[model samples]
Target: MTFEMLFVFGLLAVTIALFISDRLRMDLVALMVVAVLAVSGIISPTQAVSGFGDPVIIMIAALFVVGEALFRTGVAATAGNWLLRVGDGSETRLLLFLLPVVALLSAFMSSTGAVALLIPVVLSMARKSGLQASRLLMPLAFAALIGGMLTLIGTPPNIIVSGQLRAAGFEAFGFFDFTAIGAVILFLGVLYLVFIARFLLPQSAIRETGNPHPTLSVFTERYPTAKQLHKLIIQPGSPLNGQTLSEAAVRSQYELTVFAVQRQGQFLSTLQPVLSQTRMQALDTLILYGRDEDVHNFCQALQLRRLGFPETEMMKLQQRFGLAEILLPPDSPLTNHTLKEGRFRENYNLSVIGVRRQGLALDTRFIDTRLAAGDTLLLAGAWEYIRALESKRELVVLETPAELQEIPVHAGKAHMALSIMLAMLMSMTLGWLPNLSAILLAALAMILTGCVTLSEAYRSLNATSLVLIAGMLPLALAMESSGALSFVVDYLIREYGNLSPILLCAGLFLMTSVLSQFISNTATTVLVAPVALMTAQTLGLNPEPFMMSVAIAASTAFATPIASPVNTLVLAPGNYRFADFAKVGIPLQILALAVTLALVPWLFPF
Candidate 1:
């Protein structure tokens, strides 16, 4: 190796040392590597910074938005819930369903996206099932890696290897060509993780899923609204059926607040907001909050039938409406006036459900009780209206229920989000659009269609992962440009060429897998694929087995968290140490190698 090559190798050594030490952040180390290469004249500044704009970085970032949309729209939660029901509290059963499903999804989409979408899901599942996150997360990352081996578009390395074959005047790999070995690997991988790996994983302190903020039950108990809130169905010929909420003025007539209306349709029912011009129809169920006597009097006078407002129905209503604790400022104009006297519902469109004075919840009628400057009011309204209260200078939003975060803003638009995601998936699978283009369109569609808001999309990105991936890409470029990669590959093949072809394949697999642990697997494949092809040709053997081995080995990036983005994504959530991966991953790596060695030659014999 020349001086520059030696220098590049030294820089790489330091970088790896930093990564393994965990003393500095991974992204910072990657940035330092880029800066060193540029300062050392190893690479031009333009090339050094090009990684930030690489298609890989852009694609991963876009995938974050799509994953976030899936999350915010409840798609991931829906899948997680289904898996939970199928698993039925069995860890092995959960793994049986989880591993293959994630792998299959990874086969069709970006592995990073698949992992990102499911990390939260898996965490939620683990929390619910009483399993260690570490036990389940590493397997998730590994299965996603295996998933890339399932389809041509599953990962970049697969596509690169196929293109390499096509360029060599051989038929390109069919879409499902990788699926044969991949399915076997997935099956064996599931068995390994379920039986062996679980014993090896750390029993980390579980991240609590329970929110600290007060729940709906807490609000209901404090306000004593369970017995007070009632649902009334408007009967035929009721005078209130054809009148709008503004015209009916139930609050004015009976002192009961019409919080919302549940309208039943032929196929489905909808929760309608009680707006000024919202006209009630016959058979409409009205969600009301007031004293029992007042509610009974209103129902009796209006010829309405009272229905039991069960806790489950209240929870469902909580999704459409929000509950918040508001404190009246001392200088507030409405501080001395009662809720009804202040026209609270008409002026603010929020009904005061309960009042707490000096830390004591009032047991008496709060609507007619004069409000105090320091009194706390429990308000209920649509989420939008509840959110609007935050801007008022006269009142302080002391607390909002934690359930609001769990509620999807686009819950009603779940089907639309699902359709968009399916369309994106189909476009990618059928090659109707390029992967990056399809991802961008899908992310944009999510925002445009309000499946996820712009702020939510922005919050979805993992800055560390994006920076880490972008930063390391340049190091790969430097390795390829500086001849370090070729120098090592050449030396290895030159020394080992006279050996048996099987041994040669083994060596190639080992080299590719080790290199993939530190650099981009796509770069690893680009460099080693040619060597594999040339070695087979030199030995007068068919190149298919060697080429296939190289591709398979490139995906065995399980030995390090930095080996693949999938691995990196799970590093923190799994609370894994460097040795944790080596302990479990090294064995899995060896297993994959054994499987590839035993199968590739048999499947594509010379």
Candidate 2:
């Protein structure tokens, strides 16, 4: 090999090592690769950063926003809930329902985005169905991978292979050419997972699911507001100002219970619980729980100055505002940051009234407490502001109280989101618009029509996926530029030319599948598809079967979590180990190989 080719191979080796080590974020590793490639003078600076503006990268980013819109607008969850209902709380039943539905959705969008949308859904389903999360999460991810095989836009590898064919003067793949084989694999794959492979997965320690009556209900029960709660500020001149709770005897004298107390301050210590011996200082705001008449009677008895409005006015805020419950999903950006740090109120105009964690209410320090996935928040805000959160992929609004549903911020909006998604899909399938144009328009529509916000559209993207794609792209360029790709392809053809056409195809499938298990399927396809086509031409055989073999092999990225973004998304939520993926995924990879080998020759004769 030439010096440039050797240098490219050495760089590829180190990059894969870093990816496998998991010591750094994939995006950072990718940036390091880009920096090295640039400094080496292997490619122009423009080419080094060009993956940022690549049409495929843009398409992937737009697809994430579209998926988030579907999720926030409740379109995807509606489908997920339907599948859960159909599963009827049985593991076998849920698997049967979940895999096909996940696959079907993946067929239309990015498989990684599909997995992200369903991570919460599957967790919720596991809770409702009483199945182990580990049992369901792997199936969800694998099904999304299978879904990628069902359509042109399902995964990057499919698109790359089709582009290779078109670039070589052949027609690109049809939208449905992959469906027949994919459908079979999906059907059989679900059965394999539920019946055979589940034994290989270990049950993790996470509280995957439980009763829906969260910690807020406990607070509502203890405080027992008699249809009235007032934000009352104690005045300095009042009779109640200098008295402790025991001495004041507010409950005995005025029939009021102070459930919480807050004083204006600069730190997290200001908000605290009501202790009987604690004396109230001037301007201390107490949330009093009592009957409407009792509250009025107490106000008349004591010199408590009412701050903004009475309880009745609080009800009026409900006409414009509402209260709802939400749970943080895994991978929430809101986690690790307190509401103050997140600018929770300023961004959304919502107020967090209380938070629930593990069946305990946290009224005090609600804003200062850092959040975590699966923690619940009881929030109040204007209906529009609350509805706006519906598009935030990080938070899953569990239920909107029927009382809040009186105002109609949600009216006809779900249908609009669905219609927009359908239009985008039809445009791509029918070749009415370029995939990039259709996706960009769909993302703008999501923003213009209020499905998601401009800020959220930016948030929906995974920087790791984008940067990884951008960084790895140069490797492909380097290989091609240095004549390394041709060298490898020629070497393979020379060594294997004596073998029969079918054996050569199988060898291509094996090489591609093994590489994909370690690297990106899209990158693997980019490198392998050209070689497969060239080998077919040299053998005087039809290129379709060989090219199809390459495509199929590239997607058999099941044997490792690092193989696909879809797989990595489930890593923490499922509490899976490295061996967990290999134990189950390796068998599926072999099965896929057998299926591809048995099916490709018959489907398109050589």
For every model shown, the clashing-pair count is 0, 0
How many angstroms is residue 59 displaced in model 1 relative to the true structure, after the best TM-score fit?
1.6
lDDT of 1 by residue, 224-269 (tens): 7534777899999998988976577676667777878888662112
User: Model 1 RMSD to the real structure?
Assistant: 4.6
Candidate 2, residue 146: lDDT: 87
Could you give me the TM-score of model 2 versus the true structure?
0.63
TM-score of 1: 0.82
In model 2, the number of clashes is: 0
In order, candidate lDDTs are 0.82, 0.72
Segments in model 1 whose C-alpha atoms lie over 4 Å from true places? 68-98, 116-140, 169-172, 191-258, 266-269, 275-281, 287-319, 334-337, 357-360, 364-369, 406-420, 444-460, 494-504, 569-584
Quote the lDDT for 73 in model 2: 67
- Cα shift from native, residue 463, model 2 (Å): 3.0
Clashing residue pairs for model 1:
none
Candidate 2 wrong stretches, greater than 4 Å: 107-120, 123-138, 151-177, 199-412, 518-527, 537-544, 560-583
